[model samples]
Target chain A: MKLSREEVVHIAALARMSMSEAEIEKAREQLANILENFAVLKEVDTTNVSPTTQSIKLQSVMRNDIPGESLPAEKILANAPDREGDLFKLRPVLE
Target chain B: MTDKYTDLTIHSAHELLKAKKISSVELTKHYLDRIKKVEPQVRAIVTVTEDSALQQAKQADEAIANGKATPLTGIPVLIKDVMCTKDIKTTCSSKMLENFVPPYNATAVEKLNNAGAVMVGKANMDEFAMGSSTENSAFFTTHNPWDLSRVPGGSSGGSAAGVAASEAIYALGSDTGGSIRQPAGFCNVTGLKPTYGRVSRYGLVAFASSLDQIGPLTKDALDSALVMNVISGYDSRDSTSAPEAVPDYTKGLTKNLKGMKIGIPKEYFVEGMQAEVETAIKDAIRKLEELGAKVEWGVSLPHTRHALAVYYIIAPSEASANLARYDGSKYGFSYKDTDSMWEGMEKTKQLGFGPEVKRRIMLGTYALSSGYYDAYYLKAQKVRTLIRREFDQAFEKYDALVTPTSPTVPFKIGEKADNPLQMYLSDICTLPINIAGIPAISIPAGFAKDLPIGMQIIGKPFAEKTIFKISYAYQQVTDWHKKTAKL
Candidate 1:
């Protein structure tokens, strides 16, 4: 349950977040405390219990694989922070 | 006459609009005026759609005059900013989406619009519906109408406070854990969290997908029922939306509970619960007993103690995944200071999210990380099954269960802002219902030191009607729901 600074940084990287040293220290302490509270779950005996991903039981819904009308390029790009022509503009992925 | 329009519930407003006693435009204007007057003190609204509301209200009047009106026609409604509103900003009280307006409406918003309901404005909430108190809002915290210094329990605090202050007749909010119910309890309004899959989630912004549900916050239980009728139904757009038929929820509003069995779980009365909250809930139970319903005590939900721990794990894990959509390149706030896209993505998230959101995302990432996944995420899911089974057993012996909606009345802002665990504990009474995917409602039972107390009625899956029946009956006898904030 004790989260080290290294672990916090690794988790942040995985989550695609850049945290300052103060935030990392704060997260290290807070996440450790939260996980410590979750330690009680270890006491429950779930030898054969199945994991519940969804609360309500339902079969995956299927739909026709046909092409359908989609949002116009203009509408889809309306909220994009950076756009070029009809495509989302981003800093080069590889340099 | 203006006061009369401001005081009208959705049900009453519908009648007045139909009888030609009030026009939709007039009713919408009265609420807009109320919002203008009270919003400075309450801070419940994020964006007031004055122009669009009046235009919609004029359209509703035309529909009513043309004799083609629905039950919700001409009724002004406040929407939780988490739901998509076409051409209107849906911020979720986060800087990430501060100026992000959707091009299409959420299924719930579409349904309400089809019912002729006017969108008054978007109510404020915690960023991404992450916190128990509105303090987590990136913009500002919502004040409880009853006590301006106290927080309206959130992340649906704005929706609850709006209804209590007559800023809106009824508001829609999404509940993940106790977002809707706790705030409704704090603000002395009736809030319902319909069974998961009973309502469509197509347009709702996902926080913890499995646990989230959109419901109503209203002046009373009957208003909740009326709103439910308009909003609940299966939609092909939401894969998780149940295929089962949505009944006429209003038909369950009768003030009768003969032969009903209500269970009181012993685990809910924890050590730190406010003495006043305990007393109000017990008094409400006695009232139910006097109304010919049987009350059973000592019902054991042994897994209840572990629900909080389970929720913190599962909810954050889902949130981390759901929130991954907010990277800089697409929509929302982007960080352009960095030349590399990867650095920009990271910087955007760092700048966009607040403390609580980052904390949750970190916790979720750590739990779902390679080696830790089995120990944290898998273990929590297995315990979740146990929690659901405990409710299943309790429901077998009782028609519904009753508990104090919150362990205490609304607390002052900043009292528990620094302490995350304590804030999470505020939702102790309501989280189990969400984990079980059952329907539950928080109705005003009484007041504690001038602040409202809510008693929760929980029912089996898709049993909103049963909870409505019990809640409506309780409202018929008590004046709690009739009291309004002096603001």
Candidate 2:
């Protein structure tokens, strides 16, 4: 699975990042090398093997749904780049 | 009297504070003054909270007057910038969050505050905790307190350097892979990464949620224990936080480990390991043996050969998901206001995230995306299970495992920045512990050609107490923990 320059651009676009032509070329080469390196895993036999998510030996530890304390408006607005009376104003999401 | 206790431990600080010999205000002011003098060269702090610290110290004084002070009450502590602090600029050393302050404090920060620790400042880190050296910080690089020409190791570089320089009593650092311990090794301090879920991650801006663990970076094992006791516990806000019994870690400080067996994994002493590091580790094992502990070589962690690969796959995959929320709209470093929201996000992330971060995110998103999930992401997870099984079997025989915290001493800044694979290999010995979800500590073992090396002590899940006992006992017999960087 060699990553082409076009594929790298697609990933960047999906990830919401802009890359220059030079960066795209660099990323393509790097990604290709890494994919080649990691391809060794294809040699491993994972048949009848289950993927492990949590490393610790525990089950049934999920917490009940509960609300936590919210920071006051003063702290909330403390470092906002643009605030309009208790709201964090942004360029409107739609349009 | 002042000269005698300049390199004071956390225990000594508390005693002096109780006796009214030194107020927290004076202690904070002293370090604050030292930081002002040395920080230009050291570059350890991203922001110094002089005003809030004085105010916190005043509150500590009032608590002391009322005889209601906790062990860490009035203690000045530095936090890694990655952890969000309410009302304080919490830049994770990236332009994206340079002007961003969190509306909420991280559970760890809030817990530390509730335990009465005063915020000294936010320590500089690799951008979004992405790199292994502080050079990646958009703000400034933190120099090693031991040697200015070298780096302090990152993304917890600033925290480690602060402790090593005597600029702060102790500090808190986050470790995903080797962030906390590597810097601690480089700066000649003690760092403990508690078992994942041992500490809450509510306000920790996620890097790789599965691998990231918030822990203590301190001057000694005692301070690490003190800080851990305050920060470790269950928090409903963090669904992943472990609901285990929080023990009094300080109570086991002097517990004897006379017959406790320590395992030294043969795999860790590979060919590429520096000769100086090998010598230092052997000397450390000998010192522990002299303290009535039995040392034995064990054949364990055979899957460690693939640990780095597994980590690279899993960590970036998770990081891609975690970092996706930082679009230009809700975060800092937005592009031109005229740009559309999506356009601004693309432009902002392009300008804001470092090369390494963007690289990881791309790799991760690719791994988890529609077509390739089984080949990369799923395969890595299966290997991760094997890695954990190896540790489980090894711990069944040995009370604890010991290894070099890093294969080599800290390299110069920008030395490996250009080579991604070289940078990734730095976490070889430390990454497996995170994969296995066990508690591990990196303490100053000895120095190699004047550069410090760390001996990593690893234990079973929730066995931090055992790890500390061995570390504390070893320190009691050796002066390595007491040796300060010759800055």
Candidate 3:
């Protein structure tokens, strides 16, 4: 697959990262090389091999719903860069 | 105090505490003093819990006084900033979460605290564990303890450097691909990436959920075992956690392996490996041979060449899905000057994530997105199965596989920062195990040109005990693991 500068920008936007022109160029080249390297996977002939998701074969170990104590609010906000009354305060999201 | 305490392993420190030769508070103070003296140069810590550490040490001393203490009692430990610690700034080395603190402890932190392990502080790491070097940390990059000019290795670089410099008796590091082993190699400490399900992932911040495993970065193999025993077990909170019984990992420490077979895959000795690394690994093999283990040149992992490629696809895909949670509304770090919700999220994410992290999230989103899933993500899973099958076939005849952890020793900071491919290739020898979901460890094999070299011992699935035994045996026979950098 050919990766373009615009695609790189699109991906960056999707990933929620702002990039400079230089980073866009660098990401394009790096992703290209990685894509080319990963092209080797296309060569391996897997006619009937089942795709494995989890390495272990176990399944369905769900637990019953249970209540747990929440940590104290003071402890939660101890490291906050900015905190308000019982909540983590931040810059206004909308102008 | 200078020489002995600086390189003391968790095992030795625990022995001294048990024998009443040293007090837990004295040991904690010794490490705290060391961190105070050396952390300025290393930059390994983010938030230090000095008061809490001393209080914890006092409690440990009281426990021992009351005749009840575990093997890890009184040992000081450093956690990667990614793990949540109550009231402690668990930054994950990112500015977005720079002021973020958890209200409760991660299960691992709680377990370690209950075991009487003193929490030194949170160690610096790659922001969200996104990069190979701690250079990507939003706070600061960790310098190698051996050579201050170079990177220690990351996103677990802080933990690696901490243990290497004895800033902490032992440190816990999370490995996605080669985070644990790569830094351990560079810092010349022992690092273990336990089997995927063997260690609980409850408290560890998400990087690549399928690949991340929390393990120990320590001075020697025995301490790795001790830490592993305490950390590994079934956690009801983590669905992927293994339900298997946690064995007394230190039980096989003195077991002899006169005829055990060790495999040496020729693919690992590929062209890009540096001469010094090759020499150190060869020397380690010879030493292992002399110790009565039968060494054989084995060739089974033909798909090993595709490991790095497969890892890039698989890890990014998982990371893309895992990182979707940090959208500025529900979690830490949000930029909110924009008009729309989408714009707000974009502003927050763009401002929060670093370049390396952004690049990965993009790649992962692209791989897992529409029309490309079958070609990239699904194909990668199929290839993953083949990789596991290859290891299974190889381990049938051989007890374990041996190789160098990293191609070269610690590289200078910003050395490969521009060249991402060169940085990615560092995981060439270590990525296969994570793909196959097996346990592998990096121990100090020897040194080349003043820097340390790491020897990787790859074991079968759920057979971490075997790797521990081999590494412990190697440490007994060689003094390489005992060498300390005069920082």
Candidate 4:
């Protein structure tokens, strides 16, 4: 169950985390060790069993579409690392 | 010269407050002074809100003067750093959120605030509530109050340690998989992880959204029950919040355990578990029998063996999705000096999160990735359904389940630091309850060479009152919980 360097790199890309070569090697080793334990799940007989997304039964929650009280705009934006007049300013996504 | 307030329980403290024997401000100041003296060794609190605590205490004093006081009025309490406290820095002990402050209180915090509870400070935790040991915290590891070299089991390590060290009367802790109960066991305190949906998760930072829950860590079962009465209820803010009618938990919490049926699951007593811990739990079970509760052993939960695997898969998968919010674009740390937006996002995650966080995100991404979903994520969910069914059937035959809270007493800080799987094994005793979405409490049962041991009581969903009654009755006869850390 040793994850390859390429597989770890792919997961890091999918997770949007950049790792150095040393970190990737370490992650490959650790994640492989963790996944090896997961191999035990293959022994269970799960025929016709449904997946549980959550433990409790959930229903479609429909509430009235109305705004009662919201956080003040200034306060909500106060923690923004880079804000430009109530807008979160970020680097350009495209050229 | 010594502070008497540090040793007062919520029941006694409430009587004193009502009789005007001690003003709220005086009690609050006593704890703050105690924190100043003892906090150096424990390192439990991340941020001490001194000014806000004094103001809240003054307001509570005025309310008492007006002859209007509630159970928690003017009580000094600590909050887990994962919960947002409006205007107070809520660091999850990570560099990514070291300065992040919310504009609104978490529903639990709001409830405590509304009840006039003074905010002593925010307790530290594992980074993003990810690890079994608080050593994963970016700032510092919370030491077990009993032995400073040992770890206070975590991710709620600081909360449990603070209560054990008498830094705070009680504290709030979140449990996804045994976070609260394990720490409470190590620190010699009572910790309850309420049934999922019993408490609102709004303003509490999400980690494995489906599995995460909030509860109280306190000195005694009565104090834990009183705090549960305040924080457990429905809220529209969290979608998963239950709509069940809230019951007064302390109403029938008497020392009467007559006619209660308790079952002991045989699967939890696996090999490699410490001999002392097993003896302590067995002694506590005998005590329950003495108190009139029928203790049934050899109760079976066949699927218990697979809980650890299912939890690792499901929790990380949910965590990967829940933590996608921390891209550093909104309110947390942002790394923008990179070449492009994509690079900035990647670099923010790279530099902000610690090694364990990255490992989990990687693990989650791998599990949910194409071609592997069916084998890992989907299969785990199906097994989760089976695990939940076993608990449902077991409850049909018993009122509650009894087991050891942790496999062993507190270990040295660096004992399992290098091995992730070994650390995960530490949570084996408490993980099945969370997978089944049931409520459980870890009450101090006995000690092993001065290190405390806790026996866990598992009840059916929304059955906090039953477990509290059993623990209260058990503590009434045994003085194990009254023993405090000699810090």
Candidate with the greatest lDDT versus the true structure:
1
User: Per-residue lDDT for B1-487 in model 4, tens only?
Assistant: 2356657788788899999999989988988988998899999999999999999999999999998899899999999999999999998999999989899999999999999999899998999999887988999999998999999999999999999888878999999999999999999999999999999999999999889999999989999989988999988888899989988888886667889999999999988999999999999999999999998999999999999999999888888888777888888888978768778888889889988888888888889999999999999999999999999999999999999999999999999999989999999989988888899999999999999998999999999999999999998999999888886
Interface RMSD score of each model: 0.9, 1.8, 3.0, 0.9
Q: In candidate 4, which residue ranges exceed 4 Å CA deviation?
A: B1-3
Error of 2 at B343 (Å): 1.6
The regions of model 1 sitting more than 4 angstroms off are none
DockQ, candidate 3, vs. native dimer: 0.47
For A39-80, candidate 2 gives per-residue lDDT tens digits of 767767788888888775557667566787765877656555
**Per-chain TM-score of candidate 1, chain B:** 0.99
lDDT of each: 0.92, 0.86, 0.86, 0.91
Ranking by DockQ: 4, 1, 2, 3
User: In candidate 2 chain B, where is summed lDDT lowest over 10 consecutive residues?
Assistant: B1-10
Q: How close is candidate 2 to the true structure, as a TM-score?
A: 0.96
* Runs off by more than 4 Å, candidate 3: A16-26, A71-95
- Report the TM-score measured on chain A for model 1: 0.88
Q: Residues A21-95, candidate 3: write the lDDT tens digits.
A: 887787787788777877888988777877878787668888988988866767655554457777776556565
Per-residue lDDT of B272-359 in model 1, one digit per residue for the tens?
A: 9999999999999999998889999989999999999989999999999999989988899999887888899999999999999988
lDDT of 2 by residue, B245-340 (tens): 999897766636787888899999877899999999989988878877788975666788888888889989999988888776555776765547
Ranking by TM-score: 4, 1, 2, 3
